[model samples]
Target: MRLFLVLAFFGVLSLSAGVLMSGDDQDVDWLIAGGLFGVALAGEGARLWLRRGRAKSHESSGI
Candidate 1:
């Protein structure tokens, strides 16, 4: 979770940087933002899913 949060922070930073760097074109900025945000969301989702699986396994094992 902490790692995901850091990655998400970096993703937002990249998006903001892309926008700030974009002067004559916005398409590139949008693309950068989309990719970064997409990866961040996917990573966070996977992290949550893994955590959930771990919890279920622990419950089944009586641990």
Candidate 2:
């Protein structure tokens, strides 16, 4: 999970950089990069949230 989060964060950063470097929206490369970044970010967020919920439950159970 931690590895995934790191990868996703880096993916987003790289994609954002690509988007900024591109001259315009007509650039297919930049568009694809942006889409990949969005997916990575969403996946990371969902995983983190699920982990947090599980941790909370475990703590409440005195495990």
Scored by lDDT, the top model is 1
Query: Model 2, 25-56: lDDT tens per residue?
Result: 64436666777777777777898899999998
lDDT of 1: 0.77
List runs of model 2 lying over 4 Å from the truth: 1-5, 8-28, 61-63
Top candidate on TM-score is: 1
The TM-score that candidate 1 achieves is: 0.62
Instruction: Tell me the alpha-carbon RMSD of every candidate.
Output: 3.9, 5.7
Poorest 10 consecutive residues of model 1 by lDDT? Answer: 24-33
- lDDT of candidate 1 at residue 39, scale 0 to 100: 77
How high is the lDDT of residue 49 in model 2? Answer: 96
Q: State in Å the error of residue 19, model 2.
A: 11
lDDT score of residue 12 within candidate 1: 73
lDDT of 1 by residue, 1-63 (tens): 687677869787878977876777754577767777777778777988999999988785556
